[model samples]
Target: MSHHIVLRVVAKLLIPLILLFALYVQFHGDFGPGGGFQAGVIFAAALILYALVFGLDSARRVISPDLLRVLMASGVLLYGGVGVASLLLGGHFLDYSVLASDPVAGQHLGILLVELGVGITVTSTMLSLFYGFAGRGGDG
Candidate 1:
């Protein structure tokens, strides 16, 4: 991989674009088709490309397994927290109508938060999977 200078350069150029596109998908999801799952996969793909071009060790340094674990837990907490908050606000679980004074605004906010949590969880999970499998360093 180190010898493939052209490949490396192309990857360097492409990774940021991939990441930006993932962000676009993530943010525009509520209004359009793309969303957390798609964005997460796209984000992971960029990092996977980085790992393939740079090395697993480099990718690990960029996002350690310990951090990934924390992110996984945090994402779940975020998703669940929204539900609990809505409940505490006198609405049923996941009732976004109570999330804000304006129901429409609350709906938007809830969707945004829920989607963000999903994105975080999925991205970290996928990265963890890649690290676990790729780090094995065996053909099996």
Candidate 2:
């Protein structure tokens, strides 16, 4: 296969595995040191690498700037929403016990939502940075 074709094929094959590993890190964070932040960076790095191998325009087409902005904002909102929910339930901010009737369930839900938020923010930020750098003629 041609060079471009080979790069595309490799990106296609590797991206999914990278995402899977990110998910694993996010889910197993409680049992280990890595968490949503790490997972998000890993996920974003994979996409950035793909862009580096391909082209900025191609990466932009796949993940639009508008979408990335939204994803980043949504992540912060999700995290804040969890805290607000906790406050509404008469608990300290991020106590997580207010998430559900059962405190443990609330904790689980809080962790999941927070992790998701972190992932979204991290991915979008990294992608946006990549776009900025690549657009400035770094990926020629």
Candidate 3:
């Protein structure tokens, strides 16, 4: 890859665009077809592509495994915390209507937060899997 100048250049150019598109999918999910799962996969794909082009070690440096683990747990906590908050607000678990004074606003905010959590978890999990497979040392 170090010798593949053209490939390197192209990857550098495309990675940012890929990241931007993933963000678009994440934020626009509330109104359109894309959502947390789709955005998460897309985001992971970009990092994987970077790994493929730049090398796994480089990708690891970009995002450490420890950080990924933290992110994985944090995402779940965020999702669960939202549910708990709703419960404490005198609503059933995951009842977004009680998340805020305005039902519509609460719905919007709740969905956005839940989707964000999903996106974070999926992205980290996918990256962790990629790192595991790529880090393996064996002759096949």
Candidate 4:
């Protein structure tokens, strides 16, 4: 891999742009073409590319398996917590109108939170799978 200086440099350059595009898609989803799911998959793809170029151990050092697993669950919890919060606020489960003083604002807030949760879960899940399969050679 040390001989592959071009690959390393190119990947280093591209990874940040990939992450930025993913974020763009994540935030712009509500009003435009992309959304949480697309953003998450893109995010995972960047990480996978990093793993492919630098090797799995480096990626793992950046985000350990134990921590990724927790993050995966945390996304689900954040989504569920939002629903529960809505319920506690006197709305039905997942009903977004109660999340803020203005119903429209509440809806926007709820949707953003839900999208964030979806993004987190999808990203972590994809990264975990990539990590598991990429290390089948026991490299990591």
**In candidate 2, residue 129 scores what lDDT?**
81
**lDDT (Cα, tens digit) per residue for candidate 3, span 3-95:** 999999999999999999999999999888999889999999999999999988889899999999999898888899999999999999999
Regarding TM-score, does 1 or 4 come out ahead? 4
What's the best-to-worst order under TM-score? 4, 1, 3, 2
User: What C-alpha lDDT values do all the predictions have?
Assistant: 0.92, 0.87, 0.93, 0.93
Off by over 4 Å in 2: 1-6, 138-140
What's the C-alpha lDDT at position 95 in model 2?
96
lDDT of 3: 0.93
lDDT (Cα) of model 4: 0.93
Candidate 4 segments whose C-alpha is farther than 4 A from its true place: none
lDDT string, candidate 1, 1-140, tens digits: 67999999999999999999999999999888999889989999999999999988888899999999999888889999999999999999999999999999999999999988899999999999998899887621
Candidate 1 regions off by >4 Å? 138-140
Locate the minimum summed-lDDT window of 10 residues in model 2. Answer: 1-10
- Report the lDDT tens digits of candidate 2 across residue range 12-108: 8998898889888888888887788999999898888777777777878989989999999999999998898899989999999888999998899
Error of 1 at 61 (Å): 1.0
Output the number of the lDDT-best candidate: 4
